[model samples]
Target: MQITIKVLKGSDCTLEVAPTSTILEVKQQIETELQISAANQKLLLLGRPLNNEQTIASYPNIKEGTKLNLVVMKPCLRDSIQRGFRKHYPEQQAERLTNEFMTDFEKKLNEQSLDDLERFADSIVSRATT
Candidate 1:
């Protein structure tokens, strides 16, 4: 059997696991993939919490290809802050770089505005000649 998991602060991944695998074992695999502690991760099977000792075979009523969502809840305010930082750091970096580039571009445009039309034409002609 196979299972699909969406981990919080992690990517959506799929694992080709055995039907007899315990919930703990599956969580261990997810921990290895997501690089987070499995102890903090919560596994929900069919909208119900699966105890640490629960096994996949316990839920024989559910069909194969069942979708499972794994969530990692922040235990405290500090953990939430850390997770927020990790999530937004790349976006903040991109925004800063874009602002810098836009500033430089605007400065260049402002400097170009002082040039006369004739100078602009001459520059274009020189480029064509080159």
Candidate 2:
């Protein structure tokens, strides 16, 4: 099955792994793909830290199409701007924009942002359209 890794402020990617794969193995795969160190990766499944020692089967909620969020305490600049070159492709552009929004939302959540989620989302929509 495919597991979707959502980098809080970056584009999401899917990885194919066996159900018995350990969460740590998933992190290792992510580290290889995103160039982020495993030590720096703080993974969450539904807003809770995902234990590295557990197998994917241990978390029933983590089956096919499950989204796991990866929070990088310090984002790498090269990873961000380096991803911008494909702006001409609509699909790539859309993905880049989604990453930008997720990044912002994650930042606010960390700061205990007082803004209403709906309002914040609406602002993003408005800005995107204009």
Candidate 3:
């Protein structure tokens, strides 16, 4: 059977798949065609997320010509910050600092205070400079 996959902010693609194929298998196929990693892919059928272990046949609504939405999850903020730190610090130091920064940043975010968040960000910058 064939189905269409519409990627968010990306192009749509069609694939030939077996009814018994698992969601993970479909993701792998999408990865081959779109270059997006399976771990990052989230397939949705009518706004409901598909389970990795489930087969297409399990979803009675899914059939030939059916369209599935594909959302690609972005990398963690901590990871992006860690990469920036790696340019200036050793790997171990980068990891340690990234973890510490993310912990504090998350706490500040939870507080929902814009002024305090700005101060926290400024402190991070100052610490990085020194």
Candidate 4:
């Protein structure tokens, strides 16, 4: 079966796939066709996000010529921070610091509310300066 994928920022692509194919497999095909990584891709059908483990057959409404929305997630914050640290530190030190920072940052991220996110960002800036 052929389905159309509408990317949020790029051109739409059509893929040939089986009805039994998992969403992950569809993502892999999109990765091959569009050069977008599977990890960063989010597939949606009629505004509902598709589970990577689910199959096309599971969605009874989907058939030939169905259109799925593709949303690409932003790059990892850890990777960006690690790259910045690499400019000033050795590879091993940068890795260690990035890991440590991510561990604490993730904890705070989970605990902080949307209202507290501004304060959290300020604290991160202060920590980075010191």
Best by lDDT: 3
lDDT of 2 by residue, 1-130 (tens): 9989999879998999898898889999998999887867888988999888999999989888999999987656534443454454476675776677668867877876456767888899999999
Ranking of all predicted structures according to lDDT, beginning with the best and ending with the worst = 3, 4, 2, 1
For candidate 1, what's the RMSD? 14.3
lDDT of 2 at 83: 49
Clashing pairs in 4: none
lDDT, model 3, position 112: 79
The residue-by-residue lDDT of candidate 3 on 1-130, one tens digit each, is 9999999998999999999999999999999999987878999999999999999999999999999999999867776799799999999999999999999998877977778779989999999999
Q: Select the stronger candidate by TM-score from 1 and 3.
A: 3
Per-model lDDT: 0.73, 0.82, 0.94, 0.92
Candidate 1 on 55-123: residue-level lDDT in tens? 788877434677677988656543444455556578666556556666786677677754565689999
User: Judged by lDDT against the true structure, how good is candidate 2?
Assistant: 0.82
- Angstrom error of the Cα, residue 62, model 2: value is 0.7
Each prediction's TM-score versus the true structure: 0.52, 0.56, 0.63, 0.63
Per-residue accuracy of model 4 over 1-130 as CA lDDT, tens digit each: 9999999878899999898999999999999999887988999998999999999999997899999999999868887798799999999999999999999988987988887988878899999999
Worst 10 residues of 3 by lDDT: 74-83
Task: Give model 2 RMSD, 1 decimal.
Answer: 12.3
Collision pairs in model 3: none
